[model samples]
Target: MKILFALISTVLAGGVRYIFEVANGLKDKGHDVKIVALAGDHSWFKNLRAEVIYKPLNLNTFSSIVYAFYKFYRYVTLRSAKRNPYDTFLLISSKLGVRPDIIIELAELIRSFDSDVTVATYYLTAFSVWFSQNKNPFYLMQDFPELVEGNEGKLGLNMFYHSLKLPFSFITVSSYAKQLIVENNPTAKVTIAHPGVDLNIFRPRKANSQNQKYYGNIKGV
Candidate 1:
């Protein structure tokens, strides 16, 4: 199957790492996988199998010009600079030749890719995927974004909560995550797909003497 994973950017983060793992695994299984994002940076992991599409903003375009002004206003008005919005920072960076596109244009770009399955890695991209395609896109719920925002008054909190209400398959990496989604939208079709571990890299360390003694007394090990 042709699979597309949509994310805000390929910046270093736990959620971004999970998306990369999923894309690489899907590619290894002989499926065509592509990562579509607003921008990509080589600060963290790199992709060898899946195609990485980095659609950075083109400032010369009319849409980008308008977006720049809008972002500027948001940056000035926002109480905290940290929450000034990512697109605003992207404008400041202004790296050339990345072929960045606006979020509004994502629907057409995603439709053109003709992917059989689309996975949205965040609430923002979930809306983008929904606008691009009415069905078949999976919302990979990593966590309750509102809690991370730490403020119910934040616009992001509302948007993140509303995204769950959309008619799309919800895929959570753990049962706890699925519970969070169901709590938000009781009618959500949720599924649990646990993440894989690399045994070569991660293994339980031999229990130390204290741990062994405790376990031995408790279970006669």
Candidate 2:
């Protein structure tokens, strides 16, 4: 099957890593898999097997020009920041009258693929997937994004909550997440798909005497 995973950004995060692992596994199983994101930065993880398409926000309008200037200001002020700036920039641009343009562009990009199944990895991308031409849309609900701490006053929290109620089949990693999705949207069709660990990388190993000795000295040990 031809599958496409839509993501907000390709940053270094556990959820992003899980998406890459799942996409790679699907590719290894002989399925055509691709990932589409707003920003690209995959240097942290190595040996990515699936293809990635990056379509950053680009609007040729007066508001977009102002947004670009704001981005430049943020870039200069938050140069020492570690998080991806595009994530917040996208949210802020929405209030600047560039959101519709972004949505149209993203939907057009998604339609160009014509994949059999299109999956939204994040709440922001879910909007694009819903509006795209793809008939089969699935949301990979890894967690309760709206309930996450530190996002209380941000626009993303409200958007995340609203995205859950959209008409789409949901796939989650845990039964707890499934319960949350059902509670939030009673009509949601959710399926649990637990993450798997690779035995080659996580198998048992013989204990080292020196390491044991060092750890044994601690009170907890």
Candidate 3:
């Protein structure tokens, strides 16, 4: 079966790793797999079985105008008002970097490919996929994705939480994550698909006598 995984980035994160692994595993089983990234470090695409498609999104004309005005407002506020720099950046960067229309364009692109199965790896991507009218696209939700601050941050988080109730089925990384989605929408279809670790990379090693003695002493203390 041909499969497509839609994601915003292939950065070095747990969710990104999981998507890569799943794509690789499926490819090994003789299924065609591809990854779609909006914008990310080009180096992150190296050594992947899935074909990486880099699709950079530009703001539409109206959005660009709005963004310019928003930036100007922010600049003026920063100069006149005393605000926490981190919070300010978080508030502005959350939705400004990628607007809803950009995600919609991305979804349209993915749908054009006509894969047998399209998977949305992020809530935003899921929105894109759903809006594209894909029938039963799998949503691989890895986290709650509350990586913002301030009133705008809570709004972003709420948007993500509500997206779980959409028609798309979900595959969560852990039971806890599945429970969270269920709590948001009891009728939501979610499954737990735990990630696997390579034992060779994380295998236990025998401790040296000195190391063992140090641990023993520490335990006693």
Candidate 4:
């Protein structure tokens, strides 16, 4: 089967690592897997088996300039109020579907690729997948973003919470995550696909000189 995973950015994060590992594993299993992202730092990950496509948002467009000014105004206001300005505009824009330029750019990128299934790796990407001309959209929910600590305010939390209600099959890492999704949106169809460890990289091994130098005095070596 042909599969595509959509990511907001390929930054150095555990969730992003899991997505890459899953894509690589799927490719090894004879499936055509591709990863699409708005931006990426490819140097962080090496020896990737699947294709990664980066389609960054056009910030030079007239609409984007207007959006940037609006964001700047909001940033100033939030900073004056001593609140986190980051993610505020993006969360609201995504919830209200007001940023046509960003949505359209992302949608066009997804439509450019043909895939039997397209998976959203984050809530923002979920919105993009919903608007895209893609088939079999699935949301891989790593956790409940709304419940995450350090969110600016209730408004931000609400936006994250409401995003979960979008119509898409959900795949999560743990049963607890699935429970959270079902409890919040009872209509949501969720499946638990636990993350796999690469035995080749992570397995029982004896302590070498380097390990002994770091933990030679520890109780368990």
* Strongest candidate by TM-score: 3
Candidate 3: clashing pairs of residues? none
The sequence of per-residue lDDT tens digits that candidate 2 reaches over residues 1-221 is 99999987788888999999999889999999998877658878799999999775664587567666766776799864343435656656555633444455667788889799999887767888999959899999885764542433356677777888989999999998888788889999999988888798999899999888888888465
The Cα RMSD in angstroms, rounded to one decimal, for candidate 1 relative to the true structure is 8.1
Q: lDDT: which candidate is best?
A: 2
Reference-based TM-score of each model: 0.71, 0.76, 0.77, 0.71
Between prediction 1 and prediction 3, the one with superior lDDT is 3
RMSD of each: 8.1, 4.5, 6.7, 7.4
Kindly give the stretch of ten consecutive residues in candidate 2 with the minimal lDDT sum.
145-154
RMSD of 4: 7.4
List runs of model 4 lying over 4 Å from the truth: 61-103, 146-153, 204-221
Pitting candidate 1 against candidate 2, the one with the higher lDDT is 2
Window of ten residues with lowest summed lDDT in model 1: 93-102
Worst 10 residues of 3 by lDDT: 81-90
| Cα shift from native, residue 16, model 4 (Å) | 0.5
* CA shift of 64, model 4, Å: 9.6
Error of 4 at 152 (Å): 6.4
Backbone clash tally (model 4)? 0
- Order the candidate numbers by lDDT, best to worst: 2, 4, 3, 1
Residue 104 Cα positional deviation in candidate 4, in Å, after optimal superposition = 4.0
TM-score of 2: 0.76
